[model samples]
Target: MLCVLSLAPFSSPSQSRSRSRSQSRSPFLPNVRCLFGNGKQLQEKRRRHSKADAISTQEVLDLFDQLSTAQNPPPSIYQFNQLFAALVRTRTATDNPVFSLFSRLIQAEGISPNDYTYKIMMDCCARTNQVGLLFGFLGRFLKEGCKTNVVVFSSILKSLCWENRIDEAAIIVLDKMPKMGYAPNVVSYNILIDALCRKGEIEKAMDFLHDMMSKGQEPDVVTYNILIRGLCHNGEIEKAMDYLHDMMSKGREPDVVTYNTLINGLCKNGQIDKAVDCLHDMISKGFEPNIVTYNTLTDGLCKNGEIEIAMDFLHNMVSKGHKPDVVTYNTLIGGLCKKGEIEKAVDFLHDMMSKGREPDVVTYNTLIDGLCKKGEIEKAVDFLHDMTSKGRKPDVVTYSTLIDGLCKKGETEKAVGFLDDMMFNGHKPDVVTYSTLIDGLCKKGETEKAVDFLRIMLGKGLTPNLVTYNSVIHGLSKLGHWKEAFNVFRELVERGFLADDYSYGAFLGSLCKQGQSKVVNKLLDLMIKRGLKPSIFSHTS
Candidate 1:
């Protein structure tokens, strides 16, 4: 039971009692009666949100200034609502500026906010994680009477669903509103279904679908799309496909979204052939595949290790008049790099530029990683310079890749230099970066320096994972620091780090070199006691 205004009621005790008296006089249930509006009408109204859609934050501020200084007639509440909606929807919008603008609007003479105004404010509260203040706005929205705009109540349902208050939203908005002669419509049902699906409540969402149909509210393409997407997301692809059949039997034609969702799901499940067949099926059904459709397929092909096939598919996509975007290029480059085809990946990068498609940070990072893995560190640095020259910033991944290459080549000091340069460039080293450096230092017999770095990482509040702990145990064991190595191993275990085969092997192999045969055998017995089978590497060690 999620509370809409569980934080605290906003109205005064006397005002609440007065409202209670007013509600009791009416024939409706005061406890459950809420504002409900026609969702179809709300959709129609939003379709006309062109002016609000194009309006920016600065333009909204300018409108406010104009409103404040206007001489005779003040601006209409409709105009005020449009500007308010634009401000609330701004991506970079902060709480204070929005509230300040809203506060000034309500205070202005002759400006009375409508359902649209309350809806925008409610959305703002939800977006800013200020749900506690939600009651104040909702109270005002519904204060008009029990029979206000359904759209505002729809906003309440959306807000509640967004907050994962599904049960309360369903009962209060879905079940109760209908008893007051305002049954939830298809749009209302879709909102609840989408919410439930997002929470992985597929069974409950399906129940809502059945209930919606039992009420004779026909499910639209959007409704089925949501169900299909949810089923696919939950790994119930077969069930999702069954819904597609059910939808067609009900005469609702499957749209591009339906096909795309199934294709993506099939690809992820390693059913590439089926994904391609689905694409063909989509084309046969007279639906043109969009850029998203192609990109998803190309990515699928790449992940399946069919790099050449993916490249060919991308070329086909381009020939079909759908230009390859940066994502398509990046995906191909990453696949080629993973397959050790660095030259081909570099060629694609050049080709991408020739086609006026700018390579992003991902493109450069993938290529740099490929070069480093091939021991072409010098070439990798050149590409790094090239990346910076093009005004693209090298992130932690860029620096980390270079550091790893340097460490592998036994250039520990140079790797440390790159770490400094990484910080100087305003990029903080993540745990992976620190771990790479520590591993390199330990491998070079710099035990004291490696320990210092471990302390620095911990001081920075970065928890060292299993890889980090494993590196320390291996290094300390190699240096014949038996006590410290065992202590570190114990610490790793107590920290809930489960040792894998490499964990045991690395430590045993290191000690084996020091002729600790007896110790190694005893350790093997302990490993078996802990339900860990010794790998051949451990037995050989």
Candidate 2:
């Protein structure tokens, strides 16, 4: 028989002993009964339950198995609940093992779950993104005569929002919730609003906010923050500001998150001056600017070709006791590289290291790419070696940058060598790498080798994009390989890639150069039929 023990009403050791002494003195007393058999046995059961609760799920399951077959009485519902809670808590994958456990608890163990059990199971369903399982559990809960409450529906709504099923979640919140006698709370509305904003549905989110207010629900700071962020993301900065003012007017002050959202939006939209002004306003409002605010402003200045000003901002940020992180250094390095200022970028790299901030792969890649762009391939190669020596493995971007640089400098053979090295290092060369080498070989008058590379690319199950095909076709046409070029052109058309002006121009030019008047006239007719006028170069050829 299962020796079920109630989980509550555990007495302290001193109290148990005191009660034991009193019971021993008056065994005939009306209210002097031991509900737990004895004080010692009660403490033992409490100890066992505590151990079960503290151990891992697997260990608890093993203990349960031992209790089921041992000479001692079987474990209680409290122990089973502890095991179920452990299982729900420790689960990491998408699969819902709790459902199966629940069935075992009913059919095999003959144990009924309490409210805590149902709540934890619902939490598990939501955390694991098992929406279907959550609904199934809800049905079973109602069928078992369990009273429905806000927490249950809230868990379901949270799961729906997590899965991005906002429309269905909205229906449940605005319609089904009230019908079921459970009014949707501010938290429920906030979940739906955040989900809508994430999907770029700013207008729908606003309507929901207004609906919430019409229902006499005062929007909290969280509510205003969501609207501000959504508006900022959608580039509706003016509206976001209006709401910020409205939020303050409603006696709800904007938080750091609200100001940061506005600053990020302004920076992204290229209104750096306004972002700076907003930053000052934030300071005046007694909100300390965080690292994110500085990073956004610094990045915006760099992107707008105001690197010197951006550097000044970086100095000011350091003066404010804000440390420059990897992101800050990387952004500055990339900006300098973009302006062909590799030396200054390198100086910042040194500065970053001196400031006790380690340079990441992005920092190295940006520097390498800059050096390559400036025709400093040797220096780039040296940086590559330095990266490897420092135990930082170069990724595909690193190899591709080096290969492209070599190709541009007419070192196609070395580029191919780098490709082989990249593969040997377990980094697969992507389309850009292949296309760079192909274009390099084509420009070097090695069309046949380029064709071989294309064949290898196809063999690897990588479909050549338009740029690849265009490069090959142009190469073959320049070499007077009219038939092969035409075959490639026909393949391009058959593959459903639109033949642009460059495509038509190359094909027509080759045919014209060969003096193939009949074929040329037919090609011209097809181009005209397709509403493509021949380029001046194609006509001259």
Candidate 3:
């Protein structure tokens, strides 16, 4: 989560009361303490403890217990607020425990929940995705006559939006909030707009934007950024750019986030050069591109087969005092591997380690996959050992890549050994692993063994996907098992998989080879009825 800058520190009940009293005092004695008795001391204590380092949830509970047993009969709200803040910062599960703590605070300590208390509870609801609990809390808040400020309402709207309950959020923003004497602010508008855009309802999002403008609410940088990102996500880059122009015309300068969104969209849409132009434009606009900006451009260039240019951008990033992170190195390594530059990719890996940027599992997986595809299976196997020895465990992808390479090299028995090794290492073979091995066995004229593996996959409760079924059908057809092939094809259709051209061709060819002309004609008619066109290969067979 990105941290927003705030002029005031986190407010507690005591601090708020002190602030209210201070506001009425004369300007000449700004530091004069209007707070009396224990309240002033409690506020000072909270100020001192609030700046403490993050503490665990258990520590928070312990502190609460200590305060409860203290010479003071009831603990200050500021102390509870500090504990709550610490609990939130520690990323502890704050739902039930927080509710229990609040119950104790209200029932036993007789402490009234303040605005900051409600805000913290709402935040907990949002972070834990307990929007249902938010409604319960709101009812209690209203019953207690707690003011529903914009911040609290925004938190509720944000939680609803996060859960994709945009309709409920919209009702709150458009109707319920106004009825409660709270107008939807720019933050509330942005939350709903972002949600709508994420759900691909760009038109509805635009309607809300226009409605906001009509109500005399100026769209801020966040509002424009959300719309641009949504437009880019929906592949409407041209429209996104138009919105960018509109944003600038409305006197809202595009920020780095705006340009980064455009750059990512352009790259995904295969407009790398245009993305580069956007980067340059951002630099000229006095926006120092952050790591995200540089990483986005590097990935775009790498994906477009512009590896050399991507590397140059990396150098530029370093010269500009931006250290390349793991993501930056991974993108470049993946590009190098894709271009069959395995050696160069390895060199980059070493460079990354020398620079104190350790290669992760993704880094090793990319290089291993590249080596396997390049038919250097031995080197790939060695690299897998090196990865494990360096405390980087090989995932399914790493093992699967090596198994596939071994199978493709006609080393089916060796691939089977690796499969056992994979299982021993606590990695279960997925559909891809089984399909690869099945195909390799069939290609080696071991259809019986392939069928056995198929049964084993089913026994393991793995549903065979399209690729798996297609490979089996092709294998059985090649081995002159037309009846078995036809049965598998029928099962494929029954399972809701569309029989593609390869499927039809395989069955048609097998029937044609067996002189089953009647069966072939019926199959052809069925293919046409299913809206699958039999290719020339099917007819020629």
Candidate 4:
């Protein structure tokens, strides 16, 4: 669909000629596409004709031949620019024939490239990863005395940024093209700051911020948001908060995004009280809570074990004329499910349906998980049926949850059956899916089968994690396969796995049961030397 939408303009000479004649015509035929996702059958029909995604190289060359070799006056440079722009929008496709046509047209009768033409070429160069060509084009753009604008400077900075050569971009903006009499503006600084922040170079981004201020270009809301988000994302919540105060001191009032970033950060850092206070502060400043604000706050409360408060927050959102969205409902449902309030969570599901809020995979997964945890496996399976009937295909997590529940119920065979069912439905088992089965089989004393499955997991190129490895070790050691246990343990050490409490406990428990007290003591000494003190549970194991 994306490919067709992009290539419709330059697919044929007739279409290109028609476009040349009537520049105002939109490429999308309204008769063919009235509204996106409206006519599903028609959309599929159009998608099947995806061969039209790329314009034939011969067809484009023929169009150029007609333009360059014809007796008629050539198309206006503006028309040529339009063609280049359209071709660039198609992801620089068509074997990148635009550049050849552009170069050949530059030598044609009465045709001259305009500033827009140069800009289009710059965009093409950026898209094609031809940075050296981009600089060459930039020099020509200046040598030809084409008018320089913010877009041209931005093109260079953005092109360099795209190639991840930020230092060069930064220096070029200050060092290159001084004759053009241009300096980096606030937008330019913001672009660099944003790039730095996204790369988690927060210190460098801050340095850019200081440089921007020192150069008399003030940081705007975008500048502050980028830095704050970077700080928060890197778990520097304290630094993010300091910036929040700093932004206010500099008279850059917080926006919804600012509040949401801080709130999410505080929630993640387990500072729920601060997150709540941030909400109050936002509201007191006359900022009406949007869906994102309410949803973030609700999720924060739920994660902090304040499900009742999240419930109240939902009512508050509705009372304030903000309808609870699917996300809002899902968060509350998840919180209720976590509290073992399955009945209330189901009530929310009904309420959500009544309110015309469709339940997505997450909504159903939460309910299914809640049912599984409550040992109502039948109801959970019913939820699976309800999900498929409603046209939402179950994801890996959904089937894995079912497998986990069945295993917990000691029905390992039934759990194993789900692997076949999942694969038959075109969902290959992921690491978690296979790990769950391996753990279940091990717990069921099916060590040989579990070991075989582990081999299969590796055959499929899946790296077994600590849980998978520990599960195998526990199963083998429990059944007195100490030799195999030691082999597996050696492989784990070779793979650089530090022995966790579970790993130590598995060996200690098995040896203790076999009355190998001296071996257990030596292992304990090694564990203590590695700073892993055994817990009561570890000894019990």
Q: Which candidate leads in lDDT?
A: 3
**Residue-wise C-alpha lDDT for candidate 2, range 1-541, written one tens digit per residue:** 1122212232233443454455333321221122123455434434554532443443333333433333345455665565466556556566434555555555443457776677777778887887877776776677667887878887888899998888899998889889989888888888889989888899899889888888878889899889888888899999999998999998998988888899889888899999999999999999998889899989999899889989998989989999999999999999999999999999998999898998889999999999999999999999999999988899999999999999999999899999999999999888899999999999999999999999999899888899999999999999999999999899899988878878878888898888888998888888888888877966663
TM-score of 2: 0.80
Q: How many angstroms is residue 348 displaced in model 1 relative to the true structure, after the best TM-score fit?
A: 1.5
lDDT string, candidate 1, 58-94, tens digits? 4344435555445445456665565566556553344
**Model 2: per-residue Cα lDDT at residue 439:** 92
Which candidate should be chosen as best, given TM-score against the real structure? 3
> What pairs collide in candidate 2?
none
TM-score of each: 0.83, 0.80, 0.87, 0.76
Question: In model 1, what is the error at residue 87, expressed in angstroms?
Answer: 3.7
CA displacement after TM-score superposition, residue 188 of candidate 1 (Å): 2.3
Tens-place lDDT per residue, model 3, 41-136, is 535534544543433334444445555444534456765775565455445354335666665666544567787776787777777777777666
Ranking by TM-score: 3, 1, 2, 4
Per-residue C-alpha lDDT of model 4 across residues 151-186, encoded as one tens digit per residue: 777777777787889998788556664445776787
lDDT score, candidate 3: 0.81
Q: How far is candidate 1 from the true structure (C-alpha RMSD, Å)?
A: 9.7
What candidate 1 gets wrong by more than 4 Å, as runs, is 1-58, 88-98, 126-130, 144-146, 500-529, 533-540
Error of 1 at 525 (Å): 6.6
